[model samples]
Target: MTGQGSEGTFCLVLHSHLPWLAHHGAWPVGEEWLYQAWAHSYLPVVDLLRRFADEGREDVLTLGVTPVLAAQLDDPYCLRGLHDWLGNWQLRAHGAARGLPDLAAREHRASRWALEEFETRWRHGFSPLLRSLVDSRVVELLGGPAAHPFQPLLDERLRAFALRTGLDDTQRRIGTRPEGIWAPECAYAPGMEAGYAAAGVRRFVVDGPSLRGQTWAGRTVGDSDVVCFGRDLEVSYRVWSPKVGYPGDPAYRDFHTYDHPSGLKPSRVTGVHVDPRDKKPYDPDLAAAAVRRHAEDFVDVVVARLRSLRERHGRALVVAAYDTELYGHWWHEGPAWLEAVLRALPEAGVRVTTLRGAVEAGHVAGPVEIPPSSWGAGKDWHTWHGPQVSDIVHGNAEVQRELLELDLSGPVRDPVADQAVREALLSLSSDWAFMVTKDSAADYARYRAKVHADRFAELAALCRTGRGSTGRGHERAAELRRVDGPFGHLDARSL
Candidate 1:
């Protein structure tokens, strides 16, 4: 893991995703998850990147913002809800002041500061902030299927449609298509490489097992030139292991702790048995101190590993990847930790690069056929679209197939065809796969599947009725406008 020359280039991949939760669920559960994360993680992280760039730092970050999540973030309902939630957060801080113990005074003060920060920088929205970062070239925006559907579990007939549709959606948001992808959950299966190649995806991240017997560095999938970079699991898993990681730290915010009395989360994760009320509010000053310690430790590990790698492989680039949500959403102090780490990396002599930059810098190894693999347990797709998730998935996939066959392949062109296509793609997102795997809000997963499918079904119905569209297909534009998200105007004509 350590090599002087190889350590010079390190690539980090951040997968940012959340199932469609907007206008869907209650606080501390669904949409609240989105707003809380927006206030804590996404907004802060994007702001951090923007600040980094504003300071003339060309630090390259490979960020994957799944279209499904993006759609929700950019949705009118979510924007409005987020602003309201920010206001409520302020009220909660103010309300807490009356009952605060002297020992808890600092906690109340920190919450007030957190609220103020949210109001000033994030009250408006994060779409503009994210766009600015991408526009500034401070981070490489990666894309995947509109809803990040695990492709392998999907019926073969629907595979191409999902890939191409997602590609178009990515292009819509970022003003260009992404050649690189953060395959939803790093889930992959044999023969899926063809879909990626057809969609113009030149590179994607995978787990070490996907390399089969190959090394953890980058390699090609099948005979296609598309590069597959395997994650350096040893380093990557240290930040967010389900059993133990930074999130488990005593000083970090507890993800599972809920104040039974107030319905608000106040405690930091102390241990598995700690009571919610017994826990303490997050203190940023303490958390920031921890970040400094962790940053130094992480850098030390990277440097030593690089030195060791130099002894073995002469030069070997280490690629560490993790879910982007871990920063602020799960680990309350994640944003601070991230900032400290990035700022210290250069001083430690480690050059951070985007996934694409690594490919271009010749850090990638020679071509090799990758085996079917994912970052899931045992590098399998079980975490998403496995048996637990497949029963519901197969049913929805059938609807997808019928919809694509009827709506996409027709020669009777319609303006709403692209919107129809986008809806179809979002319906098949890999997010449902995750829900089924985790069993978190299975009903919501079913509803999301139904929502997209229902939209597609509507298009299918209109097409079958022979209700001819207006000039240039503008007559049915209202219907099209309704379906114009998760990637507006898919241009399915290419399919």
Candidate 2:
């Protein structure tokens, strides 16, 4: 929608999340996902922001971290595991020296930097680094549901609990509470704004179609003061679209063409349909040049979009949001391009600000109703609730129902009940259904969903027995707690 005012602002939002993977499986999925995203995406992205902050940039972007993922980043087990993984990565790079010398050199250098960064700065855990960023106003952090659950498909009571708990978890870690959220999956249903307002969230994001493609400015939801910022897909997809995106450029590293010996990617994209073995060796100089060109092109696009929108509205705020992992994790050159774009935007006269800054600057286009929607395929709920995930959809519903019915009220809070809540939340994570529907690590996604579901049932049944946690039940709860722990401050009674 055309928002109010003549001044134009551009807001870049990145949703950073992974399901609770602390004690879950490793390799292929689980903890591996966490470490990869952390090293390749979070580490570099945050570093770039910190560097720019040194040069005095404020409100660089809005980054959202789901509470489940936040807990993993701070967990002792995860911290220790990441240290080991970096060491292992160094070994893997060394092992590649004989097989692919050039790639080995690059990998070794990167691995060394990663390990050093982890040891010196990240060893303390995520909160300190994130807290500093928040304190300095380097970036705006957006909080979300505790488990990154699909909010539109969630029970209202659970939804509110998750949001409040998630925001509280963020406050505990970063010191300042988030006023906005990168709504889980950018998913929403009618009246959800009321729940957000109830949880003290002043703003959230949704897909463009949710606002009927009027994405030029923020719009208030229903009668609530909570504002909804629709992602401008036209701007976001220039760098993220699967087919035509800048990441697919031939000069960039090919994500799929890996040198199996060392588990490192060494080839340039060459062509979308080219055989992996036929791709050319990746050249950093070439990729850097492409980054510069694409970054300039992006700036030009934003300028043109803002110029077009300015003709209709007094103020234009062009929003472009993407998953945080997309940068270094999936697209090797993404972080460089991002830095380039952020640096160029201001020089091009575009106000680079966060979604909050947009609201504060009066970007509201007035109240509008949002329907059931998501950033998922077709801009609807099918990814989490579609026919392909019918089993998972049904399983999650049953888990939520049982948890709601269970009596967790007691004078002394029971770890059993607390874990049951955690398990239930983990089981309901949208990642499982999404993976299953998309066929990306479907087995791992299913296994995790079932594991959490089973844990929830076991814990819930023990709580229902009305016997104080003891013997086998006590031992079982402890075991599960050790593995699935996240959101330590969560109160099951919040249900």
* Global lDDT of each candidate: 0.70, 0.88
Clashes of 1: 11
Tens-digit lDDT track of model 2 for 348-448:
78888888788888888878999899999999999999999999999999998998898877777787788889899889999999999999999989998
Tens digit per residue, CA lDDT, model 1, 104-168 = 45545645665666567654555566767777778888888766777776766667766676677
TM-score versus the correct structure, for each prediction: 0.87, 0.97
Determine which window of 10 residues in candidate 2 has minimal summed lDDT: 1-10
Residue pairs whose backbone atoms clash in candidate 2: 1-214, 1-215, 4-315, 5-314, 5-315, 6-314, 6-315
TM-score of model number 2? 0.97
